[model samples]
Target: MLGLLSESEAREVEQVVAAYPEIKSELNAMEDALTQYAVAKGIPMPADLPGRIIRRLETLDKDVPPGSTTPPQTDSGSGPILPILGFLLITALAGAIYFWFQTDELQENLNTTQTELQQLQVNCDQIQDSLEQIVLSLAVLRSEGNQTFIMRGLPDKNPGAVANVYYNTQAQQAFLDIRELPPPPAGQQYQLWGIGASGVPQSMDVFNIPQGDGINFIPVPYLADVSVFAVSLEPAGGSPSPTDVHMISG
Candidate 1:
């Protein structure tokens, strides 16, 4: 009992407790001292002291084996589980990153493919338009044996402009060939007219020609006794009637 112990013994026990690296190892000895001290003093044990001794004993028991004083098993399988779980976590994280990069690459490729497809579609449309123009040009050249009229631009209005008219009398088709003209201003276009025997101009077709390379071929379904061919400047899509005389090749 601590109370029964001489002052030197009590001091010695305290010194031993202080000398130990782990305070948890002194719980049993501390409890023994408290019990002997309470009995020797003819006093009941303090309520707080039992609870404190139990808590300290529990802490020491976690690190010390039962029946023997050797330290408890430190390997609770936690070390192995941690490393394995960490490896699995890292693997999952890497897989997610790889998938993200792969998805981005696929999306970029898809966008590129879509752009190329759109350009191809535009090229196809242009090729189709050119083919139609070629077919019309061939039809006009085949009618070369028919009555051909050379309509020179009016020297006063357009000195450098020239055009040709091919009339297939057998087929009753008129083909117009404008060889020289200036480019129309923005929002304006050129229209062709057939002047008949009665001097009345009939609406024929509308076309646009680039500067320097001013040739255009247009086919007319109906051919009457046309004496002259003319051209006029109209709106972008042409008008029901000529707006102004830009160039007349007749």
Candidate 2:
């Protein structure tokens, strides 16, 4: 018989232990309180206390009693089933921890995969755009009688550098093939211009030659007549007026 805990002490212990979400864990907390209470009162714990506790726990487990089940009748409030409930609480806590870590790992992996997929999509779009531009360029060349103009690079620049200009007299379109020309320096680009006999230059098209084998097409506006075609080096997007003539051809 355990009557070591005072009435007030027993009430406090019950309230604290019952606050747990799992009543089974509360049962174990009650057992610990009882053991401490007995020791403080100079009462030795019974030798068969563990065996009695296991037997009572087995009965309660078989019944699958509700969380609100009343404590088993005993001389004191402490019951033998408390130890078993504590073991069950520890097992549940361990399982919850394992699941939480597993879920976090899965989320991290999903985020990594999503990032990779987005990068792949961007690469695919760039490739598709390049292919479309190439197809359009070829179609324009085949549709008209194209006059090829070899635009020779100007002096003070790299020699042997040249660009091919395909002028379609009927369609009045110019397709520039800069595949043979070297890449422009940083912050600079090649801009095409239509040179009139009056020595005035009209903005035609401004474009860049891509890193490898670049080709581009520009629709030539009908200017009635033009003396020559010119290319100038300007800022990246191109200047409103020609700065320096890089190459010229008639």
| Per-model TM-score versus the true fold | 0.55, 0.57
The digit string of per-residue lDDT tens for model 1 on 15-111 reads 3333332433433554566467556745554457567546544444564444553322224733334334333443443355346446666776898
Q: Considering every candidate listed, which one attains the maximal TM-score?
A: 2
> How far in Å is the alpha carbon of 235 misplaced in model 1?
6.7
Clashing pairs in 2: none
Which candidate number maximizes lDDT?
A: 2
List candidate 2 segments past 4 Å from native: 1-81, 180-189, 196-201, 211-227, 235-243
Q: Find the 10 residues in a row with the least total lDDT in model 2.
A: 1-10
**Per-residue lDDT over 193-227 for candidate 2, one digit per residue giving the tens place of the 0 to 100 score:** 87766888988767767564445554544443555
The C-alpha stretches of model 1 lying farther than 4 A from their native spots are: 1-81, 186-189, 205-216, 234-250
User: 100 in model 1: Cα distance from truth in Å?
Assistant: 2.4
lDDT of each: 0.61, 0.63
